[model samples]
Target: MTVQSIAGPRFSWRGPSNGWRQREGRGPTLALALFILVFSLIPVGRLIVAAFEGGFGAFWQVLDAPDVWRATRNTLVVAFGSGSLALLIGVVFALILSVTTLRARTALAFIMVMSLMIAPQISALAFKTLAGPASPLLKLVGLAPAPGTPNPMLGEFGIIVVMGLHHAPLVAITLASGLASIPRPLIEAARLDGASPWQVVNRIMLPLLRPFLLSAALLAFVAGTGNFGIPALLGLPVGYVTLPTLLFRKLASFGPATIGDAAAISVLIALIAGTGVIAASLLLARSASRLETDHRIEPFWELGRWRPAVEAGVWGVIALTVLLPLASLLATSLVPAYGVRLSPSSLTLAQYVEVLFRQDLTVRAFRNSMLLAGGAALSLAVITLVSAYVLDRAKPKVKAFAFALIELPYAVPGIVLAIACILLFIKPLPLIGVSIYATPWIILFAYHARFFAIALKPVMAAMATLDDAVQEAAVCDGARLGQRLRHIVLPLVFPAVFAGMLMVFLLAFNELTVSALLWSAGTETLGVALLSLEDSGLGAEAAAVAVTATLLVLVLMLAMQMLARRLPPNALPWQALAGPDRERRG
Candidate 1:
C-alpha cells in the first residue's frame, strides 16, 4: 500500500527504485547559482568597493559638503510629499473603482495605466510646454502669461507635482490588488447591521486597508527617492537638486574623476531605497493577517442619483491626467520651432521628419535602444526559465534567498545600478584587457541586472500552476532533465515566458536613468537622445522624439491587450482589471 501510494498509477515519485532519481544532477542548479551571483551579486559588491575605495575619505568629503546635505533634504521632502499626495489620490480612486457602480470604469482604469507609462521626463516636459507663455494650448485659450515670465515648472514644486501624478496610478493598482482579497461577507454583514455606507467604509474597510496604503506610500517614497528624470528635467535648471540629479551632474561635469564621490552618492540612494523596502516588508508582514481571506468582495455601492456626476468626474480626471498633456505635447512637436504658435499656418512635420529620417544621431539612438532592449529581453527569458525551474526544485530557504537576489537589483534605483556597473567594469578585465565602460555593453549589463525580477515574475507564476505529475511520468520513462524541460516545462510556460520578455523590452527600451550615465557618443539611447535635445534647447525636436516614443509604448500595450486572451491569468500587469470590468458590466 505504501509503495502504491508513493508511486501513483500515472506517475512515480523520485525514489531509489526509479532510475529517474539517479539521472538528476547538480549541473542545472550550479549553473543557475552562478548566473544569479554574476548578474545580481557582483555588481552590488563592486558598488560597495567603489564607495569605500579611498577608505572613509570619500565619505568624509561627501558628509562635509553643504550641497550634499541640501540635496538630501530635498530628496526626503520630495519623497514624503509626493508619497502623501499619491496615497490620497490612489486611495480615493481605488475605493471608487473597486466598490462603486461607476460607469466607464474600464476606460478610467485604462487611462490611469497609460498615465503611469508616460515616462517621468515626458510628463515634466509636457507640463512645462503646457504652462509656458509660448504654450500653444495656453495661448490659444488666452491664458498665456507675459513672454518674460519665469517658467513655473522649473523648480521643486513642479518635481513634486509630476512625481505625485506619475505614481498615483501605481499606488492605485497596488491598493486595488489588496482590496480584491477582502471577503464580500464582511462588508455585507456590516451593511445588514444598518450601518451607513460611509460608516461601513470608515469603521471596517479603512482598518483592513491600512497595510496596503502603507505599502503604497512606501513604494511611492522609494520611487521618488530614486527618480532621476523628473528632477533632472524640472529641478536642475532652477538649481533645485535631488540626490539623483546631483549624482548625474557630478558624473557629467567631472566624468571619471569623480567616481569615488559619485559612488558615495549612489550609496546614499541605495540606503534610502533599502530602508523603504525593508519598512514596506515589515508593514506587509504585520498586516499579513488581513490578506488571509480568499473570497473577493463584490462591488456593492449603488451611486443612485450621483452616478452621472461621478462618471463625469472620473472621465474628467482621466482627460486631465493623460489626454490633455499628451495632446499639448503633440501640438508642440508639430510646430516649426520652440515657442512657435501651433496653427495650420505654422504646423509642420519638419521636426518629426528630421528626427526620424535626417538626424543620424537620433536614428542611431533608436537603433541602439532597440538592440539593447531586445537583446536583454531575449537573453533574460532563456535565463529566467532555467532559473525558475531550479528554484522550483530547491528547498524553501534556498528559494527565498534566490528570489531576494532577483528582486534586489530591481528595487535599487537605476542610477545606482549604473554606478555599480561602472565600478565593476571601469577597470580593464584581467584576462580580456578591455573595459566595458563608455560602451553599450555596460548599458546591456545594467538592463540585465535591473530587469531580472521583471523577467522572472511571469515565469514563476506559470511554474506555480504547472502539473508535476507529467514531469514525473516522463522521468519514469527514462527521460533526461533536458528532455523533460524541452518537451514538458517549456511548452507549459511559454506564454508566460514570452509575456515577461515583452514586458522587459517595453521597460528597458524607454529607460533613461541606467543609460544616462553609461551612454557615449556612439551609444546613445532614445531616452538619452531626447534629454540631450531638450538640454540643448531644441524643445520642439525633443517633443517630437518624446511623442514618437510614447506612441511606440502605446502600440506595444495594444499588442499585449490583443494577446491577453491567450496568456495566463494575471500575466500582463493590466489584466487584473478585466475582472472589475466584467463585474461592472454585469
Candidate 2:
C-alpha cells in the first residue's frame, strides 16, 4: 500500500463518539481555521469594501492622473528591466558553477546565496555608499561630480541593479537546481554526436529548463514590482517613484478619500501579483510530474590554458556584485563626515559611540525589532508545522482549498497587506474592539502574511520525505494525534522547522516597508529608524545604525549557517522520497 493508505483514516473520534468527540477533536483545528479566517480573510474583505465604497470615482481620478500614469509606467519598466537583468545574470552564474570546471565553484554558490540573506535596504545603502556622487573611486579617477550632482547611474538604473542583485541569488539557486535535474547521459549523447557547446545548450538544456526559468522570472517580477525599500531609498531621492512609494505618499496625507484611493491601488497590485502567482503555480505543477533526479556529474570541459581567465572572471563578478559594495559601506561608517577627503585623520569611532549612547531611539528600535522577530519566528513555526502536517499527512480529505488559501498571500506585497490590515481593523468590530493600527501586532501580522510561504515550503518539503509506514506503526500502537506529532513527526521535521524559523527571524528583524507604514511613535524598528535619520539629514547617524543592523544580521545569519551544518544532509525529505520512485522505474 502507498503511504497515504497505510496512514489510517483521515478523521477519527474517541469514546462515546456521538459526533461529540469528533466535534471536540476538531476544536483546535476549528479555532485555527477561525483565527486564519478573522486575521487573513477579514482584512482582505475590508480592503475590498474600502475599494468599492468610494464608488470607484476616486480610483478613476487617481488612475487618470498623469503622475499616476508616470508612476505606473515607471513601476512596470523597473520591474521588468530588473527581473530580466537578474535572470540573465543568474543564468550565467548558474551555468558556470553547475557545468564548468571553475575553481571555488562551491564558494561562488555560497556567496551568491548570501547576498539574499542581507535585506534589500541594507544592500541599497551599501551600493549608495559605493557608487554615490562622493564615492572614493570617482574621486580617485578625478571624475567626482559636483556636490549635489544628480547621478543617473545612482538613480533608477542603480535601484534596478541593486534590486536585481538582491534577488539574483534566489533565481540562480532555483535555476541551478533545475539545470542539475537534466540527465548527464543526454548531454554526453549530444556531445558524442559532435554537437557544439552552444548548440547543446540552445537546443537541449534550454528546452528542459523552460519551466523553472519561467517560474523564477514570474517570482522575480512580482518581487521587483511590489518591492518598496529599494525604490524608497534610491529612487525617492531622484523623484523616481513606483506604485508602493506613490501609495505611501497618498496615504501619509491621511485624508479619508485619499486613503480610499490608496486602498484601490493596493488592491490592484495584489490582484496583478496574485494572478501571476497562480499562473506560475499551475505551470510548475505541470512540470513537477516530469521532474526526476539525474545527479551524475558530467566530465568538465577542459578550458586548458584559458581556465585561469575563466576563474578570474567569476571571482571578479562576485567581488563587483557583493564585496565592493559592502566594503564601501563599512569604510563610510568610520569616516567623520560625508564627502570629506579620505585621510587617516578623518577616521573616527565618534559617530558610532554617539549613535549608540546619545540616541535612545536606537536602543528602542533594537528592542522592538527583537520582540517582533522573536514573536513572528515562534508563531510561524507552530503554524507552519500544523499546516504542513495537515496538508502532507492528511492529503485529499483536508480540503484542497487549504493549500490555495495558504498560497494566496504569496503574491500580495507587504505595503498592500499593511493597507489591508489598516482598512480592516481600524474600525471597531463586534467582539474585537480597538484598532490594530499603530500597534506592534500589525507588524507581526504583516510579517506572517509576507513570509508564510517561505516558512511553510521547507517544512512541507521535509514532511513529504518520511514514509507513511512510520506514522502508521505509531498509530497502530495507539499514539494519539498530539503524541504522533510530538514524538514521531516533530522530531523528524524539526530541522526544517528550525531552518525556517531562522529565516523568518532574519527577515522579520530586517523588515522595513510594512513596518514603515504601520509603526507609530515609540515603535520604531531599526529599518525605519535608519530611514528616518537619513531623511532628516543625519547621514552619519544613519550610517552608524546601518552598520549596527548589518552586523546583527550577519551574526544571526552565521548562527543559521552553523545550525544548517549540524542538521542532517537529507533534511529535504521530499527529494529523498521522490528519488526512490524514479529509481524503481529506471
Candidate 3:
C-alpha cells in the first residue's frame, strides 16, 4: 500500500511526526532538567558550601593531629580488611554453588539473600553475644578470661568480622549472577580438551567473571568505608574509631568547630566513594565490551563418589557463615542471661516479653520506623518513576545528563547524604518554613536521597525493555498521553514499580547510619532505639528488638519475591534463564 493511502490521504507527514517527537523528547527532557536541578544540584551545592566556608580551614588545621591520623588509619584498615575477607568468601561460595551439584542450591540462595537482609547492627550484636567476654559460649569453652579482662571480639577484629559478614551476601549474589551468565559450553569444551577442573575454573570462569567480581568488591569497599553501625557497636566499646564514627562523634559533640570538621570529613568520604564508583563503572564497561558472547549449554556433571563429601562441605560452609550467627542471636534473645549456660533451665521468653510489653520505647520506635519507611517508600517511588520515565523518553542531548544525575547517589554514602541534608535543611528556605532536624520528615528525605538511585535502576531497566511500538499504536488509535500512560504503561511497568518500592522500603526500615544522625529524641527509629538500649546495658531488650526488626525485614523481602514471581515472564531473571520454554509461555 502507498504511504498516503495507508496513513490516510488527509494526514500530513511532517506535522504529526514533529509534534510527537517534541512531546516525547523535549517535554520529558525539560522536566528532567528541572528535577535534577532541584533535587540533586541544590543539596550538593549546600554540602559544598558547608565544606569550604569554615569547615575546610578547621579540617586542614587538624589534619596532622595524632587522633585524626589514628582514625584515618583505622578506617582504611577496617574497610580493606573486611572487603578482602568478603571477597574471598564470596568468590569461594559462588564457585561452589555455581559449578557443583549442590543439593541445597535453592535453600542456599534463600539463605544468602536472607543474610543480606539482616542488618549490620543485628549481626554485630549476635556476634557479641556469642563470643563476648560474658558470652555463655566463651565460658563453656573456658575462654572467658578474667572478669576485668578485655574482650577481643569488641575491638578492630570484631568490626572487620561483622562488616565482612554483613556485606558478604551482596558479594556472593553479584558474583553468582555473573557466574550464572557465563556460557556453560565454554567450560565443557575446556574440560573435553583435557583441562583440569582447577585449570578450567582459573582460565575460563575467573576471566569471564572479573568485571562483576571487581564491581562487587569495589561496591563492598565503599560500603565498608562508610559503615557506622558495626564500628560504633563493636569498635566504640574498645576505643576504636573509624571515619564515620568520628564524624558522628564530631557532630554530636557540643562544638561548632567539631561540626565543621565533620562536614569536611563527609565531603572527603563522598569524593572518595564517587571516584571509586566511576572507576568501577568505566572498568566494567571496558571489560564487558571486549567480551564475545558464547552460546553453548553443557550438561551438569555427576560428582560420583565424592558427591556426598562435597555436599556436606557446602552445607558446613553455609551453616558457619549464615546459620551460626543467626542461631546465636535467636538463642540469646530467648535466654535469660548470656553468661549462664544454655540448658533447658537457662531458656526463657521473659526478654521478648519485657521488651515488647514493658518498654514503651519499643512501641514508639516501631511506629517511627513504619512512618519513616512508608514515607520514604512512597516518595521514592514517585520521584524515581518520574525521573526514570523522563530519562527514558528525554531528548538525547539531556537524557544522558539526567540519567547521570539520578545515578550520582549510588556513589555517595548514606552518612554523607545525611550530613548534606542537615546542611541544606537547617536553614529554612522560603518555600519550606521549618528546620528538618528532629522531624520524621527529615529522615524520610534523607532516605529518599540515599536510596533514590537504587529505585531508579530497576525501573529504568524495566522501562528499557518495554516495546515503544505499543505506545505508538495506542496513540494512533486516538489515545491521549495521560490515557496511554494510565491504561498501558502503568500495567506493564507495575513489576518494576513494585520492585523499586520493595527495595526502598527494605532499606529505609533497616537503615542506621543516616537515621542515627538525623533521629531526634521523639523520632527514633527501631535501629536507633536498639542502639540506645545496647548503650544503656539493656542487652536482652536490645536483642529482642533486633530480632523483631529482622523478622519484619525478612517478611517484606519474601513478599517482594512473590510479587516478582507474579510479574510477566519476561520481567524475571529466572525466566530469562529458562530460555525457549519461557519465551513460548510469554
Candidate 4:
C-alpha cells in the first residue's frame, strides 16, 4: 500500500509488527487529544447538561411550546424540500458532466461550486435584491414588484428555493466522486446490448449509484437542517422561523435566562442532524458490498446532436444560480439609493466607496473576519498535523471515537455550536475570571469547534497514502518522534496541511452562522456586519459589501485553481472536473 508522490519525495510504507502503541514520543499526541476534547467534546457536553439542568420537565415544556412545534415542522419541510431540489439538480449535472459530452463543463462546475462558497446570508441577500421592490435588475426589466411590495424572497418558499440551489453543488460533488468509481465496462456492455442512454442509466447506472444519491440527499438534509444564514435573513423578516433562527431569536430577546430552553431547542436540532448522518453512513456501508475495488472508468455517454442544447441548459442554470443573483447584487450596489433602478443616468459606485472607506464598522468587520479566520486556519494547521498522526496510528475503535468527536460539532448546525459555546462560556472562568461570551474570542472558540474536522480530514487522507515503512525506517535510524515528524512526516504531508489551511480560511472568512449569534456590537464579522446593514435599511450598502466579499472569495478560488495541478489528485474538489483525465474520458 505504498504511494510514491509524483512530484515530492517518495512515500513508502509497511505494516507495523507492533501494537497500536508506537515507540514514538506521546507528548504531542496526548496534547492534541486533550485539545480536541476541550474544543470538540466539552462544549457539546455542557450544552446537553444545561438542556436537562432544570429536569426533564424543562425539555418537555420546551418541546411542548407551540413555536417549537412550528419550527420543527418548518425545519423538516425545508430539509426535505431543499434536499430533494438539490438532489435533482446535482444528479443531473453530475451524470451529464461525468458521462456525456457536455461542453464547458469544467467552467460550469467551477461556477456551481462558487455558489457553495458564497455565504448563505450573502446568497439570500443577492436573491433578495433580485426580485424585491428594491431590485434594480428586476426594475430595469420591468419585472420589479411595486414600491410597497414585500420581498418575494422573505418566507418559507424563499428559504427552500435558496437552500436548494445553495446545496446543489454538494450533491453534485458527492455523486461525481461516486460516478468516477463506476467501471466503464459495465456501461459499455449495456450500451452494446442496444440500450439507449436513458435505458442504460435506468437499468445499469442508477442502481449502482443508489447509495451515492441517497448519501447526497442525506447530506443536503443535514446542511439545510442546521443552516442559519439562509433562514435568518429570509425567514426572520417574514415570521417564518426554523429551529436555528428560533433559538437565536429566543436567546436574543430573553438573554441568558432562556439558556435552558435554547439548549432544549438545540438538542432537537442535534437529533435531526445526527439521524441523517447516521443513516448516510449505514446506507453507504450497506452498499459497500456492491462496489468493486477496481476504479478504472471511461466516459460512457455521448449527446452528439443534443450536446448544444444540454450545454446551453447547463449554462442557463448557471446564469440563474450564480450570475443573475450576483448581477443583481452589483446592480443594487451601484444605485444611488435602495429600490432605485439602474440606468445610464442613475449608476454610481458611492455604496462601495462608502462601505470600503467611509464606514468604520464595515472596515472593522473586514479586519475582524480576517484576523479570526486567519488565526483559526494557522492554529488548526498545527493542531491537525498532530491530530491526524494520532488518528492514523490509533487502534480502530479509538480512532473511530476520535473521528466522531472531531466531526460532531461540525455535523450539528452552526447555530447549535454557537449555543454550545454560549452555554459553556456565559460565566467567568474559574481561575481567569473573564467572560468571553460577548467577545471575538467566543466566536473564535466556536470556529475551532466547527472547523477542526475540516482541517483534520485532509491531513488524515494524505497520511493514509504514506507507507508506514518510511516512519519505521526513521525509527530504525535512531530518529526520535519529534525528529521523524520534522524530517519525514511533516514534509510528506505538508501539501495536505496547506490545502486544509486554505480551505478552512476560505470557509471561516465568509462564515455568518456562528458569529451571527455570538457577535456583540464591536465583535461584528463580515456576515454579521452585512446583515446588520441590511436590517437597518442600508440595503444598497449591504449589497456593496456582499459584492466586495464575493470578489475576495473569487480571487482565493482562482489561486486554488492555479495550485490544483501541483497538488495531489482530489486536493481541490473541482480538480476532477478540470483535469486532463476528464477531457480524455470525454
TM-score of each: 0.94, 0.88, 0.88, 0.94
**Candidate 1 residue pairs in clash (backbone atoms < 3 Å):** none
Tens digit of per-residue lDDT, candidate 3, span 420-511: 77787766667767676668878887776777777777777777767766765665677765676678877888788887787778777877
Where is the poorest 10-residue window by lDDT in model 2? Answer: 577-586
lDDT of 2 by residue, 1-586 (tens): 2433343354232212333234236645664576467556777778888887758786676577777788888888888888988889888877666565566554566567667777777788778877657765455456667778765545779888998998887677667556656777888889899987778778988898899889878878888888888888898887888988898778766644576778878877787677767776776666655765545434345556888898888889889989887776766677776555455777778778877777888778878998998898898898888777655634353535666676565567888888887776566656867666678877888788777767777788788777767776676677787887889889998888888887788888888878878888888887888788777866666777777777776676566556553354423222221121222110
**Top-TM-score candidate index:** 1
Off by over 4 Å in 4: 1-22, 467-470, 576-580
What is the per-residue lDDT of model 1 for residues 348-461, given as tens digits with 9 covering 90 to 100?
Answer: 999999999999988999899999999999999988998898777566667878888888898999999989888888899889899988899999989988998998988988
Show model 2 residue runs off by greater than 4 Å.
1-24, 27-32, 56-58, 136-143, 146-148, 255-257, 294-300, 396-401, 565-586
User: In model 4, what are the clashing residue pairs, if there are any?
Assistant: 12-467, 13-467, 13-468, 13-469, 14-469
* lDDT string, candidate 4, 108-184, tens digits: 77888889988999999999999777789999999887788888788988999999999999998888767776777
Model 4 global lDDT (CA atoms, 0 to 1): 0.84
What overall lDDT goes with each candidate model? 0.83, 0.72, 0.72, 0.84
Worst 10 residues of 3 by lDDT: 577-586
